[model samples]
Target: MKQRLNIASDTRINALLCSSAAVLLAACGAAGAASAQTTAHVYTMTGAASKDFALTGYDTNPLAGAGSLNGAIASAAAGAAGAQPRLLASVATANPSSSAVTTATTEVTQLYQSLLGRAPDAAGLAYWSQAVASGVPLSAVEAAIRSSAEYISLHNTAGSTVTVPATPYNYYVSPTGSDTAAGTKAAPFKTLARAAKAATRAGTTVWVAPGTYAGGIKTTYSGTSSARIYWVSTTKWGAKVVPPASSTNNNAWDNRGNYVSIIGFDVDGTNSGSGTKWTHGIYTGGSYGMIADNHIHNVAKSVACTSAGGSAIGVDSYYHGVMTDVIGNVVNDIGPAGCTYVQGIYFSTSGTIKNNLVYRVGAVAIHLWHDATNVIITNNTAAASNFGMVIGGGDFYHTSAGANNIFVANNIVYDNKYGISEQGVTGKQNVYKNNLIYKNTTYNTSLRNGLVATATVGSDPLFKGYSRTAAAPDFHLTTSSPAIGRGTATNAYPTDLDGKARNATTGYDIGAYQH
Candidate 1:
């Protein structure tokens, strides 16, 4: 028996109907120069005590002919079985959505919202987007969404009291304590490494005391989606991580733990010897990891201009399809004055990079290279860099190629040499819109080489104060700001960089600061 793919031409997704022409739907705002108009809602990761929908389904198996679907859109080749429908690309009949999303990302998001009643996380978006791009039928995708534990849990009316997850155990790390001691508040561990060793359980949080700590800390802990191992500084940006007196090539904090989080630490590397070079301030390669509320600065600043090449925050897309949340971090002063090699935040693959303030970095403030795909970059303020940001892959970087459902929205990319550039020839359906990309020396947007942005809010983001030196930069939106109430909630972060919620009175405001 052969499979028939029936993609209904009508927008109402009643049944899978057939069509002849190849309809290419963008995973992330793929088509139409439509204005962004997604309704703002608080993001939730509803599910069982075992897992959450936001981070689950990231590791879903790709459709069999996913590779074949790449480069050239092809119809889904069904198994030599019954009259089941073929899964031919994102052949979706548009669902009724408050959001005007018309791409693969939209389809997945609509399913998540309508079926599961929550926003699609980076991992879920990436996995399902790929599934859709690989020609998984919308009906089957809808079935999968309906069968998810999260969806089931949401719809469960069993009349039983749901058990809430308990808070995880806490470990302490301080310079005044000894590693030999138990990792308690009173008897805190001396080194972060010792705390890391002790915090092997799921959701075990390690709180570091205020003091300078030696760099090159590595975390190999593992945790579940419901119980991530959290490493937090007792004071925001107080527990500083500085490279050892004579370090080179190594990083400040190499976090490689699955479902781990590093929060509120100051990773400063400006003190490394002039001849020495540190790779990155905070590098997390693990899946479902969170690097937030931290200040990463001067990663390779002390190194010579010609030798400087590193990032303040580097989230390595090691596992290909995992989600890492890089949020609410301030990355600044990285690299020698004009080093093209250095960047503020560099990552690849699927994840959420939001509510971040990247200021005065050397080159591209934020970059996605090497296996780049399915990312949401929103609510970030990037300023005073050679390039505000660059999202592209393929031969330009070597060993990297992609651009699928890469969503960018509600950002303030300002005062850079060039604003929001793109590369790679194989890229497609990457959205760049509703951003305040203003006052750059050169082009505000240069995605012509890859894919062009649909629309850009070219108005000057009237911040409370603007400084190129990063000395006293204040990116708060004033009353008469052009960025006020202009942002779309599509892939938008609810919180600003200061850990404050967006203005409740007005709609979504662009940039890192809402109020």
Candidate 2:
């Protein structure tokens, strides 16, 4: 038995009526009908549910000149004589019952990949797919995924933890060792360069014993996300690295590895030659790296006719790397004669710079310049520098790619030429909150471009025993200090500079120490 569907005029008119009813149902109805109506409406409007379906047959069809189903639907609904159901049927066939399930699965997979950095598991895949099938829009699902805590923690680059393996592969370097020996505790390599070359794999650690090594150490090894490479000193400030006289652009250690950590070493650049050539104590690039618990000093370049010198600990990205963690380091005396452009911690991109002590620097202690964003500067103590902290591009160099979204909080700034200075284009939208700024020669806080302090105190933050002329200054706050229990409670560090809890019950104290 052969039954032909004569869908010339009457059938098309019936389909048009059905599509209009589906559109109305989609606007207001139960979940099941709404879901069906959504599909019908999309097919009726686009003549296909997906781009691949549209390109396959709709583009070549002679009746697809306008590329819209609106005219055909309207004509069919208006009882036009030449209307055809074959075109509408083609769109319906293109989006079969299986196609809806495939679309839902694809959407869920894409959302999981985008928001969680992984594919959805079976349970999650089924749940999101069912939600999409039950009349939840994909946009709403995406918004919910983005607002989740997991997504926030993953995307918060300044606060995310560095991935390190439980059992690390170990190598050793010593002053009185041979390069030909195995880099073990008993038979260690003589030079840092040799140890760095040997420590190539992820989770590999190069441990340097107490020694002064000469010549620049440049590492080009990379580590995986789950197992970061580490170069650590046997004792903090015990292993020292000094740049050689033959070094052209003097740098004690130049690291260009992703997920690599440089920890607990003394990097001295006292012998760097004078020139316009860049000089640094420890220069870093790549991304997701850490510079912690180190002592860096006396690295500076001679002032040029136009530009200034480099930094002591420079977190730069000449090749588009992003995000570093610079924490718990001591940087001091880092500038050449009359050089006003040097810095203790200089960053050009996103980073977390916290719990560091900077003193007697030629320029700003912490400088965020050129395209730096999403930086958190907290719990740091800076003194006897030209400026305590400077946020914004340098006006002299006219560094156009300035800073934005900089969070300057819970820091101690005192006895500098200027406490804090904000200048240039990126100075806008910076948050200066809960800082103890006092006793600078010029001003406590300087603001530009409608920048406002969240809750800043410009008075002396009565320390235990602090003096501008003291050999070693103590910055612990007294009980009667106004900074006690005066800071904004939210977003303060759990532990202060001395690893003490920030607050008992009342509130957080300002500056590097808790009262």
* Sequence-dependent TM-score of model 1: 0.65
- Position 512, candidate 2: lDDT: 66
Candidate 1 per-residue lDDT over residues 1-515, each given as its tens digit? 11122121211121112231112121222221121112111111222222222111111221223321111113332222222222223322223333332366678777765554356666446534544544444555564454444444333212211111222366778989998998776688988767767888885767688898887778887889888787777667778888776664468888778988777888888777543468688887788888888888877775666643578888776544368888888888888778888889987657889988898888788888766678899989999888888887653333445756778888889989989877664356778888889888898887753566655688889888887864768888889999888888787776677655676567888888877
Quantify all predictions' global Cα lDDT against the true fold: 0.65, 0.65
Residue 307 of model 1: what lDDT? 40
Location of the lowest summed lDDT over 10 successive residues in candidate 2: 1-10
RMSD of each: 20.1, 19.4
TM values, all candidates: 0.65, 0.62
Candidate 1 Cα misplacement greater than 4 A, ranges: 1-167, 246-249, 273-276, 305-308, 319-321, 395-401, 449-455
Which whole-number lDDT from 0 to 100 does residue 206 have in model 1?
Answer: 74
Stretches of candidate 2 exceeding 4 Å from the true structure: 1-165, 245-249, 271-278, 301-308, 394-401, 464-471, 478-481, 489-493, 504-506
Q: What C-alpha lDDT, on a 0 to 100 scale, does residue 332 get in candidate 1? A: 86
